[model samples]
Target: MAVESYKKIETYKASDVKTKVVDTDVLIIGGGMSGCGAAYEAAYWAKAANKKVVLVEKAAIERSGAVAHGLSAINCYLGLSGRSQFTNNKPITLEEFARYVTLDMMGVSREDLVVDYARNVDDSVHLFEKWGLPIWKDENGKYVREGRWQIMINGESYKPIVAEAAKKAIGEENIYERVFITHLLLDKDDKNKVAGAVGFSVRDPIFYVFKAKAVIIATGGATGLFRPKSTGEGMGRIWYAVFNTGSGYSMAIEAGAHTTQMEHRFIPTRFKDGYGPVGAWFLLFKSRATNAYGKDYTENVAAIEKYKPYANASPVPTPLRNHQMIEEIVQGRGPIYMRTEEALQKLSAGDPKNAKKLLEDAWEDFLDMTIDQALLWAATNTEPDKAPS
Candidate 1:
């Protein structure tokens, strides 16, 4: 059944490959935020049990996954310092957080999981601040708020700080960087149980077989699976991490793990071409996205009604907001723009003396997170006060 084109011109014997076996009490795949957090927590319990924890990363943990480049804000933080317009100016409670998540996800979210995350996310944020990540604070020393649940941060070194702590906790000897896990190894007697994993090094021809008592796959999302707008050389310029190819999902599915919502994917709107983050502009700066006619199309009741109750939800669901924008383009109001100049001018008007500082803050938003956006601005000689992004 094999095609002639699929045949290799040259082949090597199996003996030509090198294999190494590693045994650990817990095996963690991927080195993104989730993997690093898992390793940090697992190390404590692992050490107490006198067990070994091994983490394998396809790339270096210091600058890997979604947070590799950096971030301008901690998008999730439910602490006493947290303040949100959606929360009615009070600290967000566990129940409220869970409700918000459930609503935002269109009731597709697990309430128990959402509550658990809400309860502990603040501690992690505090830990990040304690670990030398500068969280922006107001004059009263309260953490600056950026929309609901988000806090401003000078996060150029966010991953490095988290990765350093995780490395220290897990120990340098246990980490296997540059090792890409190909698949999970199931127990021979019970095929449903995961016994270990198999991978190979990116640097060498050596193959790795890890025999873990338990395996944790935190390999982030399955980006690049769908066709991207940018093709060829610019193909890698996507909103999400390009390296995340759903290897974990594939491995788990192959081992008989059940899954749902496989067809559903979160599509976010970003700055045109550069794929720059629009969060800071929308949430922090309170910028409005308008159609080519300079109309705030999000206010279009007709479009919002199509998505029903989800569109009417507090803060409005991300998908619904994107839907309105897409509807605009489909309706011939193409080339939608974020009212950046209007937002900047309004913010500067409030603090006329600090206009220059405000401009720096706007630029820093892109610089700290998506450097490409800043580079794009530089290339185009963009002035935020003069034009929209």
Candidate 2:
């Protein structure tokens, strides 16, 4: 008798769950990098065309998504010309950039997309600056280059900057924060087209259903699909944003969209134990990687052929570098090290103004993107001297 009464009460509570309805011309599912971009454009265009726009985010847009911690550098910038002197000044054409990208993916990358990204990346970055993103610029009044096609930036508060811009484009009321979208709604007559989506508030039990003419899903990349090197209690250790749990992929799959490139995993060879940012060492400081015998294995490796024409590109393709590092390890030349002394000495002895600017920029990079790791470095008096695990 008591069990039956409890079951009836549970059913009653379930039936009492709240459901909220929203209608808009355009509904965006995720609020990460891609989602924010889509929402910003959608809202802008919708306003121009006199249409309603809605943005649904799983968390607060201010500190939500992958770039919440901030970014140290902007990759794929056209910085070959106009900028003069911290050191090397070389021109990088789109073709050279495309070639390097192709080599990085081992020829599996979408070259067309690469070219398109290269062309538009700078404009988008500049727009971010216009919206209050503090990009580091040199005394010459040009954006400071961290490496070829890369520029240093203080992007710690980038999320809020972009989110505020989005809100301004679309009314603040149109944007929904802390809404975890569960599934997309399909058109009744034509199942192929997405009608809208349904979600629930992260903080409350209120269920949300959005009805719209179009939907966009941009929840960033997937992580935690496969186990990392760390096992047991630390198995969750991973480099990518942990929040991106293949939600975008799953949503697309349910919508009958074909997903590809599952085999291509970007397994980065990073620092052991902590898995700190590796790009900072080489890209910002111009550190070189040497094997056990202090031999520069990167130049002699077969992978070097991939970036043949642009062999000396300031920052080479990540995958190509990782591949070379792994080869050295497998060949019994196990230990590898980032030779930073030469770069450090140069930085210490170089033009005071340029050196000060470089260190400040690099320090800000560590503080924003990887504060915890930066703290670890400070506590232990360590640098990127050891080989990547």
Candidate 3:
């Protein structure tokens, strides 16, 4: 269902001139959430079997990927909020949470993995605790069981405590930083199973190769597409660990390992889109859309009423797009871009001010999503003053 969600524009850059390699038991790539998880799991598993493991990052620690703002509470939304009674509330398990999201977002159930995921989540939580991750606990001094999930944070830490633990697990000798792994080395004979990987030093300019029995890719999204101000090495324009592309996936694919969650990418959003991409994409995943007049647009309305069980719930940038296409002037917060005969009655009595604010919020999100100088361009292209980025 990725279905042309992103409009790809052609661009090019230079490639690696020199290359080299090394050998290891396990090589974990990327340092983002998934990458971190795999690194910890592999290292711990290997240690249990008395083996070796290594985690590689394109840049230094604390850069590249979602750690841009570090982590605090897990955003699982496990329990219902705004409920008055505390004890009456029930927490959600990992399986239930995954089921809800997967069903609502993808229309298919992740039934098989949910059980295993639920069984092991507690272990992952404690893994954070053992790594000096601070957890907010209950009066009894045990880890607090609230909402739907656990967290190891107060606010933002430049060094997410668990990240420090990951480094320790790998150690200076095993872990390589400031290295860029552009491609995963494969078994040339059968073209199956990972033989190792080939990346290099961004600073030293040499092939940093690793011949590993297994490789885990946790390196994150196609970053640097949008200019994000992340930590340390990422501060470089190429902060994307530009060198550490999708070698892990390619290598695995070459080795006959197929990927299931390939379609899972965060929806592009703009606050100005008002309903937010979640609502729109949810409707789309449900295979529905709306009318231009803003009515309850549905492709197959009759079919939806039959299913009642489900419910629901970045990034680099260039400028912004759309240029405030909503109704702005007569609508009050309407900005006139969204103006239409249908919206007028709602505008007359329906609090245009609030509506306008909503549109503005949506518009800001538009800028956030599109990164097109829409608002700024709006001022030059039209009469309205664009909001500052």
Candidate 4:
């Protein structure tokens, strides 16, 4: 199992490569969830106005971007059907949701943007349900709430479903898959206006020069900027999509777009080794993250008080939680563990059959969202209910 060696590959310059030019009313740069969403919206207006829109994706939209592997839960739903206990059993209001986001970002969030997302997020979720994604509902016909705003789903085909809708709306002929956009083209007369974009085919030597009145850059965030824990074959094993290398941000900044919060980055504490999401374990399975000494260090009020209001906020901010864990590791109480065994036993309520079922559910959490984690478990014979991860 030797790691692949890096070697020189074929290289091409702007003058050497063949270029193809396309003209359209609107051009979309990325084909992630944001890109697909933009395509869907742009298509509606384009059809109404009889304007042409073109969408460019580095990979196929159906299984591209961060959602390619699927998600076990939709983490941003604010439906009235199922109220969260964290909000005191009341429906989470737009203002409250805005506040939560702001607090989460240490009061650095734009209230307007949060409000806009809060208002329309439910419609998107409803649309997802309508688009053949199975959303889990309780016996009471209410969506099953996982956390304050999350709802469970059999979302293994989430991106594909969304991509299908986008493809239908935008028309498949307009989308250019496997074309890697390199930069945004500025208008010749007005430097502030983006005229189009330039990219190249990943599968071929042909370069693309897309000319449009409007350009939407929906490329996701950056990953691998900082060195990861494992730098060999596991270099790609990160919480965020490895393909998202801040190309969108880089293109925008290069095209004179002002950037804010450049330093603000989210470092999620995922399951070790495989980098699996711990949301379901924490919220749904009622699991606790403990230090080497089996202490729930997040409850250390003294350390949390330093973070002030954010720490006091319901479901303490992600950064603050990471801070607590880091402190534990820094102070020689290293090797923190997810108390999966304890969580499963409590969830099963001492029933052997229920425990077995709960164990299967635990595995499904990883299999549905992160197959790597399930494979890791299999490779190591890691019975989650028998040992902490």
Residues 103-204 of candidate 4 have per-residue lDDT tens digits of: 888887788977887788888888888999988776767787788888888888999999999999989999999999998888999999999999889977
Best lDDT among the predictions, by candidate number: 4
lDDT, model 1: 0.84
**What pairs collide in candidate 1?**
none
Report the C-alpha lDDT of model 3 over 133-155, residue by residue, as the tens digit: 55555565644332334332332
Give the TM-scores of the predictions, in the order they appear: 0.92, 0.83, 0.56, 0.92
TM-score of 2: 0.83
Query: How many backbone clashes does every candidate have?
Result: 0, 0, 40, 0
Model 3 CA deviation exceeding 4 Å by range: 1-20, 77-87, 137-152, 223-256, 268-389
| Candidate 1 structure quality by residue, lDDT tens digits, 315-361 | 88877877888888789986788788998888888676677787899
- Which residue pairs come into collision in candidate 4? none
Q: List residue ranges in candidate 4 displaced over 4 A.
A: 1-16, 80-88
Worst 10 residues of 1 by lDDT: 80-89
lDDT tens digits by residue: candidate 2, 1-389: 55544433223355666999999999887777777788888877787889998989998887788788787777668754454233365677778878777766666677787888787776778788899888778787888777666777788888888888877877789889998888888899998898998888877668999999988887877777776657785566555678887877787789887677666678777654445565666777777778888888787656567666444454556676777887888787857765655666566676777766655655566776767556666677765322222
lDDT for model 4, on a 0 to 1 scale?
A: 0.86
